[model samples]
Target: MTDMIDLSVATRRMDRVLDGIGDEHLLAATPCTEATVGMLVDHVLGLTLAFTAAASKDFEGLTDTPPTLPTGELPGGWNDVATARLSALADAWRDPDAWAGTTRAGGIDLPGEIAGLVALDELVVHGWDLAVATRQPYACEPDEIAACLAFAGTVSDEQRTEGALFGPAVSVPGDAPALHRLLGLTGRDPSWAPPG
Candidate 1:
């Protein structure tokens, strides 16, 4: 149940960040890259939902299935998707271990331990993304950052080459707070903003 607890706390933190933002700013694009505030939030929420879905269901073709963004009728937008995803995550958390089964990544079959680790990493990094999108300062708790750093260190060289998901290769200072410096290395400027 530790994994469930971790995910719950992480999701709550993100929820707090998102809930703090006014609707006007949810559409703002940060200075980072192509993703607007909505897209980035979608990316994070989408990933979380995928993980939760994997845990919940055993569809053999899931990886091949492209995810559709959640939306509503009549000019629906990011908020709709975010709200739906968050609700899904909450539902998933309620019975996390029920889906605590094997998963695959990079063609490597993963047991519950590896899958939980992956989920943990998601909670940490996406927490940072949420902060950047909302322009809210988040100081990663020491234990959580240390745990993520440990996982980051173990990421295979092949995985690192896949993309910016593991973020920049440079090492974050052991002393630096996990959330800020780690997000910085991952190309997310927590302070980033668009032109007014």
Candidate 2:
């Protein structure tokens, strides 16, 4: 069996990114072509809740529904809500049981271990997206990046279709940093920035 990963690093990085967002940055373009800063934050908020539920083996409601790009204004106090949920997500996964059972997230039933890796990938990648959109510095630990890279590498070509969770892998130098490689595998340009 694979060792369980610690989620604190990814969660803390996401929290710091959340702290840097301001009202003026809400409409800024993100590396994710389909979402602006506000929409992505909304998605983060939803995913935090869904994945936390998945960690607890609670498969109803949030876990059953796949996330969509939020089109409306963020909820009041969304920052606090997101931060709290992120912490909860990390905490929920610390239980050994979470990594041992079948769990569902984003409406797909998957192994608990795979679901945990998916949650980490979301936090690490979306943390970068939010940081870049808000013009904040982003740093991910090597272990977190490696874990996400491993998960991203498992995405099949068929899963890269339109509207899929990941897109076609972008080309990056073989010697590129692990974070860059991870981003490339997830179909993101590592050097992407908000439009001027």
Candidate 3:
């Protein structure tokens, strides 16, 4: 078995950001250039559900998740849906067995350990994306940041530079906060803000 990584803090951090989001900020820009706040939320929610299934090695009906959020008023019930799924994801992954053996996500096979890391990475990165886009407060503990940093190193430079999973990385000081380093490695500027 590999090292046991904890995701409780990352899930809590994302829950805080999701709860703070308002409808007005749904259209605001985020550090992820390809997606606005609403789209990113949808993506995170889809991923939460996807990885939850992955943790248990379940592959039924796993497929592409179009950037679809529930249709309704802006930001209508978004947080409730997202937080519940994220929490479920965290719970699903809590089984140590979930971190062993091969797992399926989106109909593709991946090591369960790798899939768990990806889940944590998604929460950390997109949680920050939502927080920044909405001007809400977010803080990640050192362990969460460290796991994401290690995940960043797993992505190919081409993918990151071509803006597939990430854009070209933004540089940050080594002495910066652990969360800032995690953001920078994921192609987000530590000091980025939406244009007023």
Across residues 63-152, which tens digit of lDDT does each residue of candidate 2 receive?
898777577388999889888999999999999888987999988999999999999999998899899888899888888888888888
Q: Which candidate number maximizes TM-score?
A: 2
- lDDT, candidate 3, residue 32? 76
lDDT (Cα, tens digit) per residue for candidate 3, span 94-188: 99988999987755677888888878888888888889889888877777777778888777767786344566778899899888888887888
Top candidate when judged by lDDT against the true structure: 2
Winner of 1 and 2 under lDDT = 2
Task: Write model 1 residue lDDT over 1-196, tens digit each, in one string.
Answer: 2354455666666677766666666566654355555665656666666666555654465433544442212125545566667666656656656336666432345654455556667667766665666667765567666666665667665655323456445545556556656554554554455465
For all predicted structures, in order, the TM-scores are 0.69, 0.96, 0.87
The local distance difference test score of model 1 is: 0.57
Poorest 10 consecutive residues by lDDT, candidate 1:
66-75
lDDT of candidate 3 vs native? Answer: 0.78
lDDT of 1 at 180: 53
Report lDDT per candidate: 0.57, 0.88, 0.78
